[model samples]
Target: MADKLKVALAIALVVAGVVGFYLLSEQALVLRVLSVLAGVAAAAAVASQSESGRRFVGFARESVTETKKVVWPSRKETVQTTGMVFAFVVVMAIFLWLTDKSLEWVMYDLILGWK
Candidate 1:
């Protein structure tokens, strides 16, 4: 009975949230704040209860811990990479322009005799 009531209350909160959001969609600020409050209340109720909630909490904690272990590149490394990319693009652009000019010259002056 007690578990049923908790589940019902959580479901009610979420349903109320959805209805409220639909009604308040024209007022973005109020809708967002109310939606967040509703979500937090629902989460709190869920966390207060059975085995699934505990597992969810543990998973969330591990995710945060794993996120903290990431290593990021330095600014110097980023700048060097950016410079190399730009140099490659410039070289490719020049090569393409030269190839196009050579093709144009051969088609017009050599074959069609355009001078």
Candidate 2:
């Protein structure tokens, strides 16, 4: 029952937000204001739920903790890897272009007997 209520409320919030946005589309000022207002209301409603709210909080905390544990590459390593990737991409692009032009030339000049 609680889960159903939460789901229904979430759906209703989304529908309301969509409707509000559609209605406000004609008025730029109203659209901007209502957009922020609807977003805040939606957030507040989600946070108000007991079980769902606790889950959200836990999820956020776990995400932050996992992010902190990540081993980010050094600036020098990142730059070197980026350069290598770019070099490979450019080389592959040039190779493909040449192959395509050669195939086109063969088909039109030799096979089709076009000058």
Which numbered prediction scores highest in TM-score against the true structure? Answer: 2
lDDT of 1 by residue, 43-106 (tens): 5676468565667778999999999998877999999999999999999999999999999999
Q: How much does candidate 2 score in TM-score?
A: 0.65
- Model 1: how far residue 6 lies from native, Å: 14
Kindly give the stretch of ten consecutive residues in candidate 2 with the minimal lDDT sum.
Answer: 43-52
Query: Candidate 1: deviation at residue 93, Å?
Result: 1.1
lDDT for each residue of candidate 2 in 1-115, tens digit (9 for 90 to 100): 7866775776677677767777777778777577757865895576557577778878999999999999999999999999999999999999999999999999999999887
The regions of model 2 sitting more than 4 angstroms off are 2-48
**Alpha carbon lDDT of residue 87, candidate 1?**
100
Off by over 4 Å in 1: 1-18, 25-28, 31-33, 36-67
lDDT agreement with native, every candidate: 0.80, 0.81
